[model samples]
Target chain A: MKHWLRIEAVCASLAIRSRMAYRLDFSLSFIGMFLAHLALPIYIVLLYGVSAGFGEWSIGDMLLLTGTIQLARGATSMIMSGLIWHTNERVQQGTFDLLLLAPVNALGHLLNRSIDFEDSGLFLSGMLVFIIAVVISGITWWQALLLALLASFAIMFFASLYILFAAITVRYISTLRLFEFQDIAAQYAQFPLHIYPSLLATLFITLIPLAVVGYIPVGVVTGHLPMIMLGSLIFPVLFLGFSVWYWHNTLTHYTSAGG
Target chain B: MDIITITDLSKTFKVPKRKEGLKSAIQSVFRRQYETKHAVKNVTFRVRSGEIVGLLGPNGAGKSTIIKALTGILSPTSGEIRVLGFEPFSQRKDYVRHIGALFGQKSQLWWDIPPADSFTLSQHLYEIPKQEFERRKNDLVEKLGIQDIIHKPARNLSLGERMKCEFVMALLHRPKLVFLDEPTIGLDVFAKQAIREFITYTNKEYGTTYILTTHDMDDIEHLAHRVIVISGGEKVFDDSFAALRKIAGVTKHVRVVTQKKVVLPKKGVRGVMHISPYEAQFVLDREILGIRDLVKAIAQKTEIIDLTITDPPVETIIAQLYQAKA
Candidate 1:
């Protein structure tokens, strides 16, 4: 594990240096991500003023939900979002083979190869909102510990989704349409889970597991976690394991683009 | 010792088959036809340590596929390949530590950063000790004469300079075996010579085995002790480089412009093109009609205006081998 972290450090340092080469574009990417993630949390705050309860949730509860969604996606984006774009690009350019030549798993190598330092802006924005929401909704220290554990699971869940998308990208060689799928998942995740019908909510809670990313963690923070839905916590770990298996299986479908 | 071995290796790909005319194309959108292309057939060969072997073939003749398999990027459809006693595709992570590959068209350097940064990544990637990494890196930099170029962004460097940095990155870990796919492609003569010399030096000093695929016959002649020719996805010829020359059958293409009618060297000369009675092109068998004998025969018969003798082109030799295979 120490050796692997050293390798990851090397890849991350090089990636940051490469991004910094074009200073203006680097700054613009940071600003773009910062503004893009700021809207939903700000919108939630504003909506709570005109309406006391927006769809059966208090202002503090909604803030925690939006904040949890932002933080989960924001952190995952900083580390693994590059997997989508670069995997598509490398597969198209035939450089994906270079990943296999390394003395590490190809997926792990790609994750490090495409670290997105610019997405740190989004992560910081999410951090700001999450702290504010946590302050608004007070909780005991044990609850805080549980929140931390669940939040780690949330980030893991989002990262696994990126890997799944990357696995699909190896076969398709294009990620343009994949953004739509991710957007829909995120859009569903930011709202309270009860807003959707019970069947669709159950699907989100387990199968697709978008609820694992935001609703469950934020629900704990807001003291609204569904006792019956405690079983959903196991889905993130299962999803991560499946994503890794699926990635290696998908590699066989990689008829590399060039000779 | 046999450092590498492959037996009955094959790779097949399923591609969408196309038909002529717009109607067929439209129909194909709904229900497409597919065809299986055998990129590699039951090809087999072995390479011993410290030997340079050249894989010669025309474009799309599966040379790159074989390299990909040997590098552990692609699994063969059928067969077994063991390099240093590990299966390339199954034990790739460990097997890859013992090998390195440089595909000339694909770069290992980051385009936006100095190659020096990428080298640090390489050091950690292969888990080379820092002190050992620095020593190996400095030595390669000095030898390749890229001391200054390593600090420049790869995009700013010239092709040869960038390639030099690439070479340094590839050999930093001192892999036991290396695969080079057209390493000298699109290089100038000086750059080509430098790369060839570098390969020779590395092979000698480290006892590194090399499997090279290139179109430049000069590279084969200069470096490869053994040559393997692939055509139609099969190994058509494998032998010493001198033997491949024999496959050209000791023939040289000679075009002559004369002051008089051409006098045939009846024993070893075959007429090829008769443009005019005074001037003609012919194939001269160097073994049967020695250069000295042909010159003497010609001088005694006619006053020569101009004479040129060149070896048969590489295409003819490949065609001859393909025909022999058929």
Candidate 2:
């Protein structure tokens, strides 16, 4: 584990140095991403201005949810989503064989292969919004701990999804459509579960666990979530483990078919 | 002393077959047909330690498929492969740590980063100790003489310079075995010589076993101790370099300048190119016709002006080997 961490550190250093070569472009991209995430909360505010959003949910509450989702997406987008994009490129270019030749796990190497600092801009923008919303709606330190724990599980849950998508890239070998599939799933985090139908809401909360990303975590802090939903957050960790196993299994099966 | 062994190894690819024209293309969207391409048949070979084996074959002769299988990049469709005492495909993560591979057409260096940064990544991946990594890296850089270019991004370097950096990266870990797939393709004479010298230095000093795949026979003549020729997805020839030449070298090229119209029997000689009736060129199978007997036979037919005989080039031998029935 220590060895892998060192490998990750070296890969991250290389990625930063490569980006630093084009400093202006890197800074501009960060600004662009932050602004894109910032647009979501502004749209929510505009919608809340005309009418009431979900039942008893204030504009500050929705902003808090959006900010929390951005932070989770930002952290994963930097490492995992970039991995899927690069995996598609590597498989097409045939450089993926190098990953197999390495002594480390192929998925682990891919996670470290692409680290876009520009994506962290979303986290910065999310932090600003979260701090403001926290000021608007005060919460206890214990509630903050619960939010942090849920955020970690949310991060892993999304990372597992990205890993599965990357594994699909290996099997299919070319898929620009995967981005659409991932984006469609992720957009669910933008809204509260109460707004979605019960069946779809139950699906995301129970099996997909996307609720921990924003809805449940924010609901807990706002005192809108029941104790039963909070207990379901533990399942995301299990799903993450299963995804890891599925990734290795997919690689083994594709070895016989892929170039 | 065996470092690699492959038994009846084969690979079959299921390739989507499509017919030409818009109608077939549209129909294929709903239903597609795939054909099995037998890239490598049941072939078997072995490599002893510290030997340079050249894999020689024509295009589509399954050389890359065999290399991929041996490197653990592709799993065998049937049979087994053991490299350095482990099954290559099943035990890939553990087995690959003891081996290294270089694909000339594919690069390992990061295109936008300096070779130094890429080397650092390799060092970390292989878990090389800092002091030992420095020593080996410095030695390879000195050997390749790339001190000035190592700091530049791989995109800025010439093809030769980038190839040298790749060599350094592959060797810093000192793997027990190395696979060189077309390592000298598109390289100039000087670069090829430098790479050959690197292979020799490492093989002699570190006892590294190398399996090279190349169309250039000069690489085989200059470096390989043994040659394995594949054609039609089967091993056609496997023996020492001299043995191959001797087996494929039985025929001699002969040219005869005659004073009169001499009819050389068509049954005794093949490829008889008659330049007018006074001169002709033909190949004589030394196994069947002797030079002394030919000289006497030709002298009796006419007053010969001059006669010359020489061995055919090595490529002709390999070309014939390529067309030989499996």
Candidate 3:
């Protein structure tokens, strides 16, 4: 784990250097992400003022869900977005061959070499919004803290899922459709899970698991789910293990492109 | 003991056949036809520790494929390969520590970071201790003349400078076997000379075994003591440089220039054939051609204004060998 952290730190440094190469573009993109997060809450507030509630959830509850999901997504993006882009470039350029020949795990090298600082703004904004929603909705301190911890773990799970998808792209050579699928899933994550039909809700909570990002943990904080469902928190650990296994399997199939 | 060995190693690729135009591309996506190409076919060679072997071939002649197979990037369709007493296809971590590689057209350096950053990362990846890493890093940077460029981002360096840094990066871990594919491809004359000299020095100073594949004839000519030529996925010749020249029918060309034009009879010349007008050029089989006699015969004809003898270019010899194989 210490070795992995060292590798990750190296990757983060490389990523910062790469981003700094295009300083103007990186600055503009960072501002754009900040504004984009700011706009999301404004839009949600207007919608909630117009409607009484989204199913059983109030405006504050919806804000919590949005904030939690955005925070998780932002953190995931911060850590893994650059890695995804680098993986695609490496696969396309056949530089992945050089990485494979190196004296380290190729998957670890590919997945941990870069981080995006732009998304940190979105993450910070989401954390602020989550705190505001917690204060406004009058949640207890311990429940609020537990929800925050669960949200972080859920973000990690989502990141693992994204890494798994990236690994699949490495094998299949295209992930645009996967990106589209994630976009639609993000739409569902913005609202309470109760707004969707039971089967669809189960699908989100189980297979896709975007519900864990905001819906399930928020549901627990709001007392919507029974205590038994809290046990499902263990799924993230299992999913992480499975994603890593899948990544390794896909890595074995990797045939780098170009000379 | 042999450091690397291959027995009947082969790799066949299934390449999809795609038609031009957007409509056909979309239509064929559901029903694509794939043709199997035998990239490397039943090649077998072994290299002992501390040997520098050159892999010489034309474009798409399976040189890179063989290198990839040896490095565990590509799996062979059928055959067995062992590198440093480990199966490379298994991609065992212990085995990877024994090998290093540098591809000429591609870089392993972190593009937007200093070469030193890449070396540091590699040190961690290879799990080298700090002192040892620093020692090796300084030695290599100095030896490769990349000290000036080591602190510059890889993208900012010239091709030669970047290649120098790349060489240092590949060797920082001190792997026993190094594979260099076209390591001097795009450099100017001086840079190429520098790289060649460094390669020689590295092989000798560190006792690192090298397997280099290059299209540059001079690269093979200067650095390779033993040359292996592969044509059409098969090893056509594997021997010393001199032996390759002899086996490829490479000969010295003797050009005789006379003051007056003369027609020579083709029949009675002991060491000459394929003669042309005002100047006659002869192919001197090293065994048959006595240089003094050839000069004397030329002198007997009209006035010998000038004479120059030269060996066939290496490219032509290699091309002729390829044509013969085809």
Candidate 4:
């Protein structure tokens, strides 16, 4: 395990150096992610101006939800940026074979290879919004802790889902549309689950579960739907376990590049 | 002891078949068709420790498939394979630790970074001791004359330079077995000689075993002691290089330049390929006429000035082998 950590560190440093080599590209992507996150709040504010708020939540509560989702997305992007894009690149280019040749944990190395240090700015901006929401919500300290903890797991939840698609991409090279699925999930999860019909809300929290990642955590922080928060904790673990099992089974489907 | 052992190993691929026209295209979407390609069939061979064996074959003749199976890139469809006391595909992690592989068409180096960074990354990946890593790194850098280019990014380096660094990376861990798939492909003569020399030096000095696959016969002639020829997904020949020459019934061309014109024997020798006033070249099968007897016969007739004997090039023998197999 110590050796694995060292290897991860090495991979992270290499990733940083690789990005540092292209300063302009790194800066542009960093600012682009920061602006993208900020743009979401602007859209939320504009929606609140037209309509009082989303369902029972006020504009301030909706801001908290948006900020929480942004934080989850930022953390996921910063830590696992390479998950989708690089996996596709490696599988198509047949370089994943080289990764498997390494004696260390191959998945760890792959995750390390995908780490994007450029998303640091987005994480910081999202954190600012999240803190402001926490201050305004006037929730107890424990509620804030629970929200933070669930939000962290929510990142893992996103990872599990994205990793499943990564596994799919490895087997069937044409399944890059999974990214679009994630995009749609993220778009819907930005608002409260009640904005949709009851069945769709249940599906978002149960089947898809992106709603639990962002919206439910904010709901718990605001002292609304405390019961859903407890269930959110269990769902991501089961989903991640299922994702890992699927990943291992799909490994056998890897036919490599050439016949 | 054999480092690699295989018995009746085979690998088959299911390739998707495409149909022409809009109607067939729509049908393909509903029920795709696949054609089974038997890439490797009933092939078996073994490599003893400290041996260099060359895998020779024409294109699409399953040479790469066998290498892929041995390297754990592709799992065998059937049969058995043991490399370094482990089944290659099932025990890939343990097996790969004891072996190194280099593909000519694919590079393992981080293209945007200098090879030095890659070497450091590999040292950590392979878990080599710091002192040993430094020692090996310095030695290879010096020997391969990559000191000037080691710090340059791999993308900026020449193919020869990049390949030298690749050799360094592969050998850094001192693996017992190494696979060189077309190691000298698309290299200049000097670069090829350097690579061949490095392989020989490492093999002799460290007792490393190598399995090389290439269409370049010169690579086999220069580096390999034993040759395995495959055709149509089967092992057609597996033995020492000399044994292959003997099995092909290949003859050596003996050119003799004499001080005076000499009468050439029409019998006993296969035939004279070319003749001039003072020089003659004859193709002689050593099994039919011994070299000593032929030289003595020529010397007896005229004073010999210069005589040179050369075996038929490996390309000719390979062509004949493939033709015979077909």
Candidate 5:
């Protein structure tokens, strides 16, 4: 418990420092993100006006999904995206060797020591949507809150997956396709998962498991998924564990490129 | 007892050969070839507690490779490395607890944060107790004279100031074994001297065992009691400074400036050679020259304005050693 607290304190301090280093950039990014979030609901409202229900769901249900996904994505972006960039820079500059020699868990060091604050705006925007959606959709208070927490964990799991992919790229140095795939995945997450075919919907739930981020949990909360789909919550924990394990093994194979 | 021991350590890397030009680049992407490069080959050494040893070598001489292997950052192709009685590569966490490493070209501190913050982070990373961390940090900061700059961001500090802070950061945990790779690179003379003094004081005062790699011969001369020189992945020379000079046939160069421009005799005097007009220099050949006679001849000159003598540089001696081994 003490070690975990220390990690959290250190990570938080690093994030705060990084944010303060570029105050103007931080402010600009936050404002831009807030405006972007407001723009998204407007776009969705226009679409709903032109068309009837987005694939078996009302406009209110779609708004709830949008809020959940935005919140999860915002939290992950704020916390874990910085780690991906840090891993890449460390590998290229050969600074990763310094961390490897420290008497600490390498994955813990990398994941906790770096963070980005611009994503906080996204989180806030998502929270606003979440509150509005809960009021309009009439979700049970306890169940809705529980799913919301689960959605956050799922976001962290996906972020860890991104970090793992970046670490692998350090070794391979040629598998840039993973990045392109992530960009496409981001676009997919922007909309409701039901619009996609059943095969892809299953793929998103199982293979990538992005559905758990906001879609599945919100779907379960809104009565779209039966209690059987509560099993999806297990995916985040299992996937996070797998990512942590892969990170340790892959780090051992790190041959620092230069002196 | 030896704090670090390695046997037949070797590391080989597979480097992909990429073709240049737009045409060849596209063609080679599908049919890529790789060549194996041996970074460290059959290299072995041991460092006892409280010894400051220098790993001397030129660029691409596998010095950094060997350091990385010892630190458990890179697994050797084949070898045994025991640091603090544990296999470094297998028991990295346990082994690394007794070690601290600093690469001069890298900054372990967060660039945008104060050094004090980085130090706190390190304290937690190493699991140092609160009281112990404070005491050690205060002592190190005081000793290194970085109290004034500890709160400033690392990127805003000068090179020397940043390096001083880096040194303090590495040593705050008080590890028994320290590896410093080019710790004084790009620093001015004053900063370099400060670092050298600190390393010497730490080795003597705290009995810290250090394995330092540097291109600066002066650093080796000042701090290293023993040096291990490697070339082309092979250990070329490993011995004391005096012994290395003797075995490499390296000697001092003495330039004697005469009061008048006297032409040296056609038949050169024993133990002395006329290297330039009016400038007579002596190479002490154990076969023919004696130091007393050389000095007596220079004294006989009308007047000697100033004379200087210096040993051949370590770089030259190292180059010659490599050539001889080749």
Candidate 6:
């Protein structure tokens, strides 16, 4: 375990150095992401105002939902989502051989080296809105703590799904473009799930599960969801378990087929 | 002790068949058809503790597949493989630390990061002691002449420079066994020589066992003591370097210089390559005709000035083997 931590630190440091090399580009992208996240709540407020709110979900609820999604996306991207984007290229070029040969767990090493510091701006912006939404919604400090815990769990849960995406890419090299589906799922979190059609909502809660990542946390904070729903917490554990198992099973079939 | 052992090993891949046009691409996805490819078929071989074995084969002959299986990148479909007392696929995390591999076509170095940074990452992954890592890093950098390029990002480095760093990184762990796949594929003569020297140094100084696969026969000729030839996913030949030439029926060129003008012996000679009053050269298949007999016959005609025997080039011998199989 100590060795794994050391390896993770090395991977993170390498990623930081590489990003530091493009300071100007990193700064520009950070500003763009910050502006994009900052403007998101305004758009939600305008939409909710014109629509006179969404199914008892006021503008404050929308803000909380959007902020939490950004928080979850930023956290996931900072650590593991980049591997989803890189999996296809690495498998195609056969460069993933290095990861397989590393002394560390292949999945952990891949996730570790992929840390993206550019997401920090978005994460900070989301945190600021999250705090404001908590105050305006008059949630207790304990509930805020619960929201934070659920958000962290959601990050792991989403990261596991992306791992499954990456594994699929490894198994079928042609399916690399399917990685965009991850972003599309996260995009679903910006709005209230009940506003969508019932079928879509069912899919979101079960098969797709994007709403479960952030929406449920907001629901719990606003008294719209029972505290017993914390049992839903076990779902991420199961998802992560399945994801890890599927990844290893698919890896055994990695043909290293391409030239 | 044997560093590697394999028996009846095979690997098969289910390659999804592709059809032309947009409609077929969509339709095939729903009703997928696969073709089973036997990449390695019931092949088997072993290597002792400190031996360098060259894996020779034509394209698609499964040389790379075997290397991948041994290096724990791909699991075998059937049969058993034990390397360094571990099943490479099942015990990958523990087994890989004892081995190193370099694919000439694919680099391990992070393209956007300096080679030094990659080296540091490797140091952490391998968990080498700080003092030991620094010592080996400095020694290999100087020996491979990569000190100047080690700090530059891998993308900016030339192919040869990147390859050198690749070697440095693979060796940094000081693995007991190493697999080198086409390690000198696109290198200049000087770069190729440097790599050959590194292999020699590592093998001698560290007793590192090696499994080298290359289409470059020069690499096999320079680095490997034994050669294993696989053709069509089967072991066609496995023997020492000198024995490979003989197995391929490659002839030896014999030139004899006489003190005075003499008549050349015509019997038992496959081809009289060159002829002069005092000197003659013949290409002789030693299997059919013995070198000692020919020299005795030549000396009986006139006092021999000098005698030289040269084996055919390894490239020609391998080409002949491939052609015969084709």
lDDT of 2 by residue, A1-259 (tens): 8988898888888889888888999999999988987888888878987987777778878877877777777788887768777988888877888778898877888888877788888878877777666666576657656675677777887787888788888887777577676567668878988888899899888887778778888897788987677787777788888888888887765543232
lDDT of 4 at A158: 80
Q: Could you tell me which residue pairs clash in candidate 1?
A: none
User: Weakest 10 consecutive residues, lDDT, candidate 4 chain B?
Assistant: B265-274
Q: In candidate 2, how many Å is residue B28 off?
A: 2.7
lDDT of 1 by residue, B1-326 (tens): 99899999999988888779999999997999999999999999999999999998888888999999998898899999999999999899999999988989889999999999899989998989999999999999999988988988898999988888889988999999999999998898899999999999999999999999988887888999999998878998999889987765767788887788977678889867877987778899877999789878987899889888866665677998767658
Our tally of clashes for model 3 stands at 1
Q: Model 5, B1-326: lDDT tens per residue?
A: 88888999999988888778998788777887889999999988888999899998888889999999988888889988988888888788778888889999998888988898888878887888999999999988888888899999888999999999998889888889999999999999899998998999899899998999988767877889898997888888898866665666635566777877633332223356765556777644432444565566656755667676655555677777867668
Q: What are the TM-scores, per candidate, against the unseen true structure?
A: 0.89, 0.87, 0.87, 0.87, 0.87, 0.86
> What are the root-mean-square deviations of the candidates from the true structure over C-alphas?
4.3, 6.4, 5.1, 5.9, 4.6, 6.6
Instruction: Give the Å shift of residue B192 in candidate 3.
Output: 1.1
lDDT of 2 by residue, B184-262 (tens): 9889889999999989989999999999998876788789999998876788899987877666756778999988996
State residue B197's C-alpha deviation in candidate 5, in Å: 0.7
Chain B vs. true chain B: TM-score per candidate: 0.82, 0.80, 0.79, 0.79, 0.81, 0.78
How close to the true structure is residue B322 of candidate 4, measured as C-alpha lDDT?
65
lDDT per residue as tens, model 4, B1-326 = 99899999998888989878999999988899999989899998899999999998877778878988898877889999999998988787778999998988778888888999989889998889999999999998998988999898899999999999999988899999999888988898899999999999999999999999987777887889999988789888888877776667747778889888866665557667556789877788767777888888888899999988876654667677767668
Clash list (residue pairs), candidate 5? none
lDDT of each: 0.85, 0.83, 0.79, 0.82, 0.79, 0.83
Native-referenced DockQ of model 3: 0.52
lDDT value, residue A212 of candidate 1? 81
Docking class of 3: medium
lDDT of 2 at B249: 56
Task: State the lDDT of candidate 6 residue by residue for B1-326, as single tens digits.
Answer: 88899999998988889789999899996898899989889998889999999998877888999999999888999999999999999999999999999989888888788999899988988889999999999999999988889888899998889999999889999999999999998898899999999999999999999999987766877889899988777888888877776557747777888888855666667667557787777787766668888778777878998888876654556677767668
Model 4, C-alpha of A162: deviation from truth (Å)? 2.0
Q: Cα deviation in Å at residue A192, candidate 5?
A: 3.6
